[model samples]
Target: MYKLRELERIDLDRINKWRNDQNLIACLGAPYRYINEDVDHEWYEKYLHARNNSVRCAIVDDKQEEVVLGLISLLDINSINRSGVIHIMIGDNENRGKGIGTFAVNEMIKHAFYNLNLRRIELGVLENNLPAIRLYEKTGFVREGVKRESNYKNGKYVSMIIMAILREDYESMPSLRSENDE
Candidate 1:
């Protein structure tokens, strides 16, 4: 089984390694840049310090002796609107296709809507990432719109599709449950 927990300092190296992986760089459309130890330290500090608009967590596979399989976060939170953008990364390449991403995402959505009292949770995925797009759709996030030619990556410009799930929609979805009540 897998569980979502607060990201800790000890996981920095693993996180950075995953962040700098070429597959993640290409699949997630990350900027072509190296993520070193210093960068990871700074990012961790900011992630923990930022109070108004951020929350990050590590996805742990408990069955695997608590190994961190991935990470996810809700960033750029708008309290007034009760919304935030979701970001997730399945760092373990071997575990990528095993539905861990969906599980982590669902956990984040539960926390956002139930604990954070968010009204909407949204995310953007590259149009060509059919697997991720399908996962998001399966999780009840609708394709709200598309930003044509938004991302210039991998020798070309690609469209970015925005997906979102509202509080009501989440509540109505059978697979999701409020974190507080759970």
Candidate 2:
């Protein structure tokens, strides 16, 4: 297991390192560049300003809450539309492939649907990120479409697949549904 805690100022340093990791940046579909402390601090400030429209959490170890595992978030919340975008990053290589991502993603999905009352949660993943794509599919997210060559990375354009899970989908997913919710 895993648990999610509020993203704190203290977590920024670890996040900054993860953001600047060359390998992670490629999967994130973001331009590769060095992110310094000042830049990350500024980003955190902006995140606070947009709190109403976002819920960013730090995925931590259940036994050792202080041990940061990664980050997961639901952003661009549209109250009227009842939808949001989900994003997750398992910071270090050693921490991945250990079911942590799945646990954190499921927890976030639960929060989105039951807590935030979001009707739909969506995310985009690099086409080459097979592990992540598989994880999302396993969690009941249906592939909507692919944005052909939508992202420029390493001097080339990469395609990203759009995936989403509707509230109805969650209701029918046995692994996600609990008896209490029924």
Top lDDT prediction, candidate number: 2
Off by over 4 Å in 1: 63-66, 176-182
Compose the digit string of candidate 1's lDDT tens values, residues 1-182: 89988888888999999988877867785666787899999989988888569988889977663588898989999999999999888887798889899899888988998899999998999999998998899989999999998888878999999999998987877655554457
Q: Residue 3: error of model 2 in Å?
A: 0.2
Among all windows of 10 consecutive residues in model 1, the one with the lowest summed lDDT is 173-182
User: What is the per-residue lDDT of model 2 for residues 1-182, given as tens digits with 9 covering 90 to 100?
Assistant: 68999899999999999998998888886689899999999988999999999999999988988889999999999999999999999999999889988988888998999999999999999999999998999888999999999999988999999999998998898764675477
Clash pairs detected, candidate 1: none
After superposition on all CA atoms, what RMSD does each candidate show versus the true structure?
2.5, 1.5
